[model samples]
Target: MKKFPMTVGGEKALREELDDLKTVQRPTVIASIAEAREHGDLKENAEYHAAREQQGFIEGRIQELEGKLGSAQVIDVTQIPHTGKVIFGTTVDLINMDTEDTVCYQIVGDDEANIKGGKISISSPIARALIGKEEGDVAVVQTPGGGVEYEIDQVRHI
Candidate 1:
């Protein structure tokens, strides 16, 4: 499987989630299953069925988190040399060329991308265009509405 790039913060978040699933959720589901099993027959018990379904979901999520963590390549933006260019894990300040509206975005992994939080996925059109670009460079992003142009005002590694 191809390894996915992740920021140090993103890796830590995944690790924390994995720990929670293993130490908290897994044990809780197991106990719930045991209690449900003790209550009634295996075939007709609604509680048992529900517990089993919950167990399945918990196990599936655990596996997914483990796989993602195992294949993740964590990159620490702070440790990398600052070249004043846009790169993964870099927070960039931009100005819309058309409207002259200022915006800030942190380029991160797919799992860490949240538009509301000012984080954009590395694979996104805007990030792709910004990669390797320095301040004063213009990035043209192809959006569903149309093409949008942004001027890179600043890049910060944090």
Candidate 2:
């Protein structure tokens, strides 16, 4: 089985979702299905069909979460010694060589990546280029337009 690397926060979020699905959603959907069953025949009952569909979705999500949680390798970046080199779960500050603009991004797992939140996926082109690079080193990221160079200004465990 492939191990899923994730931050502590990411693991916690998935666990929370799993808990909600099992404790709240599963029971609620069961109740809905039972109530819909009393209303009419199975073939023409819209409410019963809708409830069953919702139940399928909830069950599927629960299984997916469980599988992810089972294989998750949670990495708490704060516990690692800082070495000024970009690594998984490290926050990196970079200066664009061509535009002179700066950007800060936290290297995170695929499920936890959010560009608006300054988190980039570990498998992304830019993050892949930045990995193993130290402060003051320039990383060239290949993009569709062309290669873009970013100078690593800082690498933080926090």
Candidate 3:
């Protein structure tokens, strides 16, 4: 499988989740399944069915996390040399040319992209346009609504 880029923090978060699922959730589900099995009737038991469903979901998630963790290339923003150019895991300050409104966004991995947290996916239109561009450069992004232009004000590796 191809390796995916992930920020150091994002990779750590996934690792923590994987650990929790393996140590806590897996045991809890196993215990629940065993308890449900003790209720006797296997075919018509609603509790048993629910426990089995929960087990399936937990197992699936564990496997997914494991796969992602195995193939993730974790990039630490702090370790990157401070360059004015925009790059992955760099926080960028931008000003919308039309509205004159300033917005800050950190380019991050797909799994860690959260607009509310000021993180944009690396594959996003804005990030793609901003990549390798230095401060004071304009990035023209094609949004769903319309074309938007943003002027890069600063780039910080944080």
Candidate 4:
């Protein structure tokens, strides 16, 4: 199996979710299903159907999280020595060459990528371009609009 690169924080969050699913959600759904089943005939039971659907969804999520955690290779950026080059789990500050706009992004695993959170996936175009690039290096990211050049200002392993 291919190992997925994940930040320490991401792994923790996933583990928490899995725990909640297995301990809280699973039991709650089971209880709901039991109660629904007691209510009426299985053929015309809306509550039972809804509960079953919810149980299926919860189980699916639990399995997904477990699989991800099993295949995860957690990287604690804070524990690693800070290097000038950009890498996974590193927060990089970039300056747009043309617009002169400065932005910061943390390269993270796919599960942790959130644009609003300033986290980008490792497979993203910008992150792929920034990977292995040192401070003062220029990374050109090809977007749907066009190519955008960003100057690596700083890289922080945090």
The TM-score of predicted model 2 comes to 0.96
TM-score of 4: 0.97
Whole-model lDDT, model 3: 0.94
Could you tell me which 10 consecutive residues in candidate 2 have the lowest summed lDDT?
Answer: 63-72
lDDT of 3 by residue, 19-125 (tens): 99999999998999999999999999999899899999999999999889889999998998897999899999999999999999999999999999999999999
The 10 consecutive residues of candidate 1 with the worst lDDT sum are 39-48
Give the alpha carbon lDDT tens digit for every residue of 75-155 in model 1: 999999999999999999999999999999999999999999999999999999999999999999999999999999999
The CA lDDT at 57 in model 2 is: 97
* Pairs of residues at least 3 apart in sequence or in different chains that clash in candidate 2: none
- lDDT of the candidates, in the order given: 0.93, 0.95, 0.94, 0.95
Error of 2 at 67 (Å): 0.9
Candidate 3, poorest ten consecutive residues by summed lDDT:
74-83
Candidate that beats the other on lDDT, 1 or 4, i.e. the better one: 4
lDDT (C-alpha) at residue 51 in model 1:
80
How do the residues 54-152 of candidate 2 rate in per-residue lDDT, one tens digit apiece?
999999999888888888889999999999999999999999999999999999999899999999999999999999999999999999999999999
RMSD of 4: 0.9
Cα lDDT of candidate 1 equals 0.93
